[model samples]
Target: MARLRRFLDRIEPQFQKGGPYEKYFALYEMVDTFIYSPADVTRGSPHVRDAIDLKRVMSYVVVATFPVLLLMLWNTGFQANNAISQMGMTGLDGWRNWVMSTLGIAHDPNSVFANMFYGLLYFLPMYITTLVAGGIFEVIFAAVRNHEVNEGFLVSSMLYTLTLPPSTPLWMVALGIIFGVVLGKEVFGGTGKNFLNPALTGRAFLYFAYPAAMSGDAVWTAVDGYTGATPLALAASGGIDAVKEAGYSWSQTFLGVMPGSLGETSTLAILIGAAFLIYTRVANFRIILGVFLGMVATSLLFNLIGSDTNPMFSVPWYWHLTMGGLAFGMVFMATDPVSAAMTNKGRWIYGALIGFMAVMIRVVNPAFPEGIMLAILFGNIFAPLIDYFVVQANIKRRMKRS
Candidate 1:
């Protein structure tokens, strides 16, 4: 502690007199030494240290994302059961919906459990394939780089799986994760060094690679025969007229009674996960709050602008947050510390821009109803630039004051 203080004391003058800058500089120095302790072991530092580890960082992320995983299990199961009922396959020659329904607490063979279990059965293979493939890549990278396998991918894999539709093929999942791990994380120098979240990279890869599995009428539902369109897709396809006739209720949407990705359908579950994340301090509330504000504001502006073709433009700005992956993405992906803007000031802009871009892309690009994935990936790439400009602007202001 004394050594760190002495080191900071030496460099403090270069930053400024006693102020937040000095304080932040000191904090950065402390974290730099502590977080970068591995470098000290190799580089022979002044031998100052503190208590912190990669496990602690990764634990926070796991803890934060736990709610999301639980919600995914329930929602996926629920959707699968509902789809089965619609297809009248709840009772088959060699049916298993009875057991599924009993366990998940949904009575009708076509109830929540039937759906949840069906979706889970289908999605689990894809999820496992992705993790295994991505894990192999991670291990190879770690072996070649001679660094410990970082904890970053643990949460990334989970997030990636959660974002996927239950029906995505296992092979496609494996390929996507491979692309994500190799291109997104490994190529960028592994783990914390990556610019974009690796999981999103995987999702993006699959989206581009297998647009059929990634989207369209079949991917959202668990049933073999029935055509299940995602709420966003339904809205996009038929606009307000299609959705109004379908009578997509708010309750159904909140309870995950809709066709969509594994975890994104349940606003209720996502909110629960959001609360858990915020409570654990794994995510920044300010960034989340600011991003919500930006999304709401931007959505309102677009809604007010009055699109002539899409009467659903009047579907209330609040719905944007609940629909699609906006809730999950904001709570988990956009707030990733490594990829996010470093400066506090930059976070506001970074988050806001992500929110804006997400909504804009979703509305403007009919082909893609879920835009948060690409938007956050874009934000991650531009984070450093945002921070750089923010710092440069601060420097200029300080110099001008002088």
Candidate 2:
């Protein structure tokens, strides 16, 4: 550790102002700060200092995602292996199968090692594509704008990769991330200044632009020609009965053993991550509580107004909590500090809006079964207005007291 620090210190002058590599200072600083905390400090008065910096905050989020990441790998492989077994095939027809065969790993769903390893093959490629494509944009923007490269992309890339279907094309992965970083964020002034979540922005672009690839029964499982509807999609079509007929129970959905997007499937895993974030104060608990209450209230209302036509109207609030990306988005996306409402009271409104809209879209709109992505984006758009009203109300109350 000492040797590495000394090495960085020795080469620091070469990247400083007026040096030959001065233009690449952003690149240098990115690597340096990533490995060690910055040496620079404020010397002036009236500056409040804290032990936690941006890097630590971002790193904590990445760390919190560990439980979700593990489940994503295990569940992805389990689904694929289980599908292949049902199809009566020995293995897939590509390199993945070849590697598994050489490694003596069978297509057995019960084998924990086999499931995780097989899932890694699917996950690693997409993650690498996201990192390379998104990192290039981050570096380019930092170099052009003459600012230190922010650590936010680390979180964005991981979150975006988790949202994608395992079989998503490598090219589409690159294109989606590029669109996300450039338009969703950079166009609005990057990272903390952006009004939208960059990860969701790119995902939304792909959802609209390439609808066939993004959704439907074919995309969830990695095996080609295997068609399986997510529990939420099943509920959308045949109500809770359809999901049960397809062999998905509330417990299965809750544990995330069923088919869906990689990280979004497991409510248990998402909650684990949420607990850590809330404990560390990285995520706002009010927003989480508000989202939960709003979802329960709306879902219960729909249940009361039972629809003879739409089965989705019968889904209970607890089922809604376990299904799809509701839990995942409530914990991660709605709590984004920059995009969420700033005022304390506004956080409640913002979260409720997301929760309400998510259920509304899932039940009322037959076209789209899952609604968290659109709901969070909607909340992000209205966050500023929500905050504005909150501020005005507070001012009026204070003035009356005076």
Report every candidate's CA lDDT. Answer: 0.73, 0.90
301-334: candidate 2 lDDT, tens digit per residue:
9999999999999999989999988999999889
Best by TM-score: 2
Report the C-alpha displacement of residue 382, candidate 2, in angstroms: 0.4
Q: What would the C-alpha RMSD of candidate 2 be, to one decimal place?
A: 6.0
TM-score of 1: 0.81
Question: How far in Å is the alpha carbon of 268 misplaced in model 1?
Answer: 2.3
Cα displacement (angstroms), candidate 2, residue 364, comes to: 0.3
Per-residue lDDT tens digits of candidate 1, residues 165-228?
8777677778888998899878977766778788898899888987877888887765566576
